[model samples]
Target: MKNSLKLVLAVVLCVFLAGVAGFADEYILGIGFTIFMYIALAQSWVVLSGLTGYISLGHVVFFGSGAYVFILIWGLVPVWLGVFCSGIVVGLVSLIVGYPVLRVRGPYFVILSFGLAELVKNLVLINEARMYVSMRPVFGAPALYQLYTAMLLLAIIATGLTYWIRRSRFGAGLRSIREDEEAAETIGVPVAKLKLLAFAISGVIPAMVGAIFIMRSGIFQSGDAFTPIVSFTMVTMAIIGGSDDAPGPFLGVVFLVLLQELLWVNWPEVYMIILGILLLGFVLFIPNGIYGWLSEKYFGNKKNVT
Candidate 1:
């Protein structure tokens, strides 16, 4: 019964998103794109950090890397194909590194993730300088509505994957890892394989997101592609929305994106300040997030979906 309602609401949302651009202006489409992109990012984060408690601080690495790949191969392939290639490349790279990366647990894992991201960012910056390329400009971009639709579709796919995984045996194994890794492995949970798979899966969409995202700016700089702010926003949204479940990202993204749209144009730095404050408050107080709070209030228990 609950799942049925969720399906109905999802359908309604898809309909609204699909139809919005027909009448809405560019600003509205931009907002929709931003919200949907964040939804994809946040949900992807949930697939890894939320379930396994790895708490990645460098999620943007995949996003930026994917965009760089896309732009590097730009004009050599169809736009849609480039988007796909971006995701595939990022996923493959994650698989290559996931073994060593996932082995580190707790705060060490957090620091390593952040350190790796910074490392990648600097490498890209230096490479760009060596190539004598300051920024890559995107030419012959798709219409705003088309990119918006693509992001919306990605968001839905990400949410569906998260929802399905959360209810599967795999999700149980993942949660077991979060609860007690050694015990889970002792009980034959296949902890290592599952973590690597989840890490790779979480990486794909964000890369595709970055591929589409660079189109919005019509240019890509190493700095913008690898910006720490993208990583911060993903963690912030997940923390606010409750990374445990599929719906948490939707609630969190909508709330913050709307607030962002209101304050961003007037005082951009102010938005960053507010984001920092909200992060601290949410972490200190409502640690379980909006979804957890609401679930405990109405549905009965604050079930940990992650």
Candidate 2:
């Protein structure tokens, strides 16, 4: 489909979903919230990893760190303010660390990203132990509808950011760097600057996503907060959605999350097995993912993000 039509559909869908949040039962609302949360996370990943071809295997570090930051100051401030602060803190830290980390390329950078997340997780774990802090149930979180609304807003922000960036000169430069860093730099692209900026941009929303997610769960554990599966799911959604443009992550997240929900309900014993099969099927048959495949079928290699 054309970008214009896709944008229209997205806006309509967002409006419809927003309208439903007010009347949907708690279970359905929770599902919608999870979907929006993943949408935000996936689009945020696309800002850096998808556009720049710098696949991040440890994106959950920001998520977990954001959760930790918010948990530490949970009752000390307004919840929304705490979520905002988490994003700000994570963004700044990523900017500082991204400078040196962005120097690596290829598989090495991937390994570094994964290792960095693990290191942060262990440090948090050790710190928690030292403080003798046991996991405590969260109390007095904001209303469910309030969190759902906030998360929906975040999803919109992340989706719009990716969409805008994908067609802008900056996004073009990032894609160029993705294709060939040395060649992009030879042509005057500020490779380091764009990568760092994208890296920082990618970190912010997920941090907020993590903060809100913890509030939803009403308890925090370092292990669950920093789990690698979060990273895996984000990457998988982007890949499955064909992170070539604005609508891809939304499609990917909805499909996977809904599929998982159904499978878990009916085939709990083999839900993961079915998911693995689906992932593998996408990898083998629909390599470009659902959006990419659709574009190819309808546009015949005609679609371009720019």
Q: What is the C-alpha RMSD of each candidate to the true structure, in Å?
A: 1.6, 1.6
Off by over 4 Å in 1: 265-270
Clashing residue pairs in all predictions, respectively, total 0, 0
* Model 2 TM-score (2 dp): 0.95
TM for every model, in the order presented, reads 0.96, 0.95
What CA RMSD would candidate 2 show?
A: 1.6
Q: Point out the worst 10-residue segment of candidate 2 by lDDT.
A: 297-306
Give the per-residue lDDT digits (tens) of candidate 1, residues 159-179: 999988998999889989999
| Candidate 1 residue pairs in backbone clash | none
Between which residue pairs do clashes occur in model 2? none
Best by lDDT: 1
Candidate 1's displacement at residue 128, Å, is 2.0
lDDT of 2 by residue, 204-297 (tens): 9999999999989999899999999999999999888877776889899999999989988898999988878888888898877888888889
- Candidate 1 lDDT for residue 163: 89
